[model samples]
Target: MLPCRNRTGKMRLGASIESRPAEVETRKTFGHWEIDTVIGKKKGKNAVVLTLVERNTDFYITRKIPAKAASAVNSEIKQLFSDFGKKPEKIFMTLTADRGLEFASLAELENESTKIYFAHPYSSYEREINERHNRILRRFIPKGTDINKISEEELERIEDLINGLPRKRLGYKTPEELFNEQLDLIYRL
Candidate 1:
């Protein structure tokens, strides 16, 4: 992977994660998310998985893309946000991602109520929640496995299994429970 600077010359498009608001760090807000792409084995025209995890609730979302191109990834991101309905900004307040070229167009996601932040180079820990979720996904879809062979139903099952598992950090509640609670709050607001 080339350095993010190599792709954009001098100017980086988004704010650094270090500049992210304190509320985001505390994970008290429901809208902040960390995004990443999980690629299948290196092969001709291999498909990839686009993953997003809500910071506060650890809610995970994934979509399969034809490839790891930035355009495909951006399109999936747009579609995901569009699924949130009229005011996507209300549900997608902030997105933090690494400097992957696949996320190069992430700035297009920013709006009046939403912002995008890029983690510093070589700092995967900054997106810890996302990384952890990806690791769990690997249990079902091992590395080097062809993503093209995985059906949507299988992916949904994997997602459900991960979200349904209770977590001690979340007071033993499943991510699905907390995520649903947050969504209810958002709707009630």
Candidate 2:
């Protein structure tokens, strides 16, 4: 796989993950997210899940997408941005993603309030939160299982289960609790 930056030092993808603000790395603030895709099968461009986990609270969001193409990913992302139905821009400060073709169109979404950063090819560690949560998600949607068979209700149940679990690293607080609290604060502002 080609690195995000080429020999000429030009970024073939979007901006480097290193260029993301310091607060994002430290998870000192909210709204920073790490995103990735979970495919059911690679045989065809069937269905997939677009997962986004907040860097700070580990609040994960999943969307059942039609395919792993740029259009599907971008559409779901835009839908997520509008989930709040108002002042949606304030909810997505930045997003860190891998150098996949599905993410190629993400650079177009970058603006004043929302920034998009691409991790170096083959470097999954940069999106650790997303990777870890994906592992947990695999418990429900195992590899080789056609995700298209999984109904949206089942996916939401799995997502809720994960978000409701208390984590020691999070001071024993559930991600859902913290996520809702933070989201409330954002909407209030």
Candidate 3:
């Protein structure tokens, strides 16, 4: 992928296939997060859903936002974390996002503890967790359907189903299991 050229000639930082390749080595960090947006419907009329997955625990969070505009995405992210109760150190330690303008203001997400990184555009393999999570989400909310119509209660149910699925990646453990384990570990400390 080329440097994201917004309407202006300025080079925007987004996932560029050439820049971010597959992981050279997988690290065992717990708080590293993979972030991406799922766009539904046609170009003109669409709802964007932001999805995040924790690399170590396979925990996930999904939030439906108004559009893919950077401002909305950023605001939704803030809201999601706030809804989860922001203890920045315990929540997100680092974030990896694709080359979408929606993530351009990643610095705002950074606390002294949380770092933000970017994946090369079109490099789906880099954010593999988000990629697979999106596929699972598609089972309930197919592509080309307006996410706006989906109520929060329904979305929570979808999230519950996704979290409750037995994941081969986790040795047949459900994401909820791994997520709770990690949370328990943190509390025990």
What overall lDDT goes with each candidate model?
A: 0.89, 0.89, 0.76
Using TM-score, give the best candidate's number. Answer: 2
Number of clashing residue pairs, candidate 3: 6
Of candidate 3, the 10-residue stretch with the lowest lDDT total is: 16-25
lDDT (C-alpha) at residue 70 in model 2: 88
How far residue 120's Cα lies from its native spot in candidate 1, in Å, is 0.6
Stretches of model 2 off by over 4 angstroms after superposition = 1-11
- Where is model 1 poorest over a 10-residue stretch in terms of lDDT? 2-11
Tens-digit lDDT string for candidate 1 (1-189): 965555556547589998889899999878999999998899799899999999988999988999998899889988987898776777789999999888888898778899999999989999999999999999999989999999888888899999999999899999899998987877787
Better of 2 and 3 by lDDT: 2
Ranking the candidates on TM-score from highest down gives: 2, 1, 3
* CA deviation > 4 Å runs, candidate 1: 1-11
Provide C-alpha RMSD values for all models, in order.
3.5, 3.3, 4.3
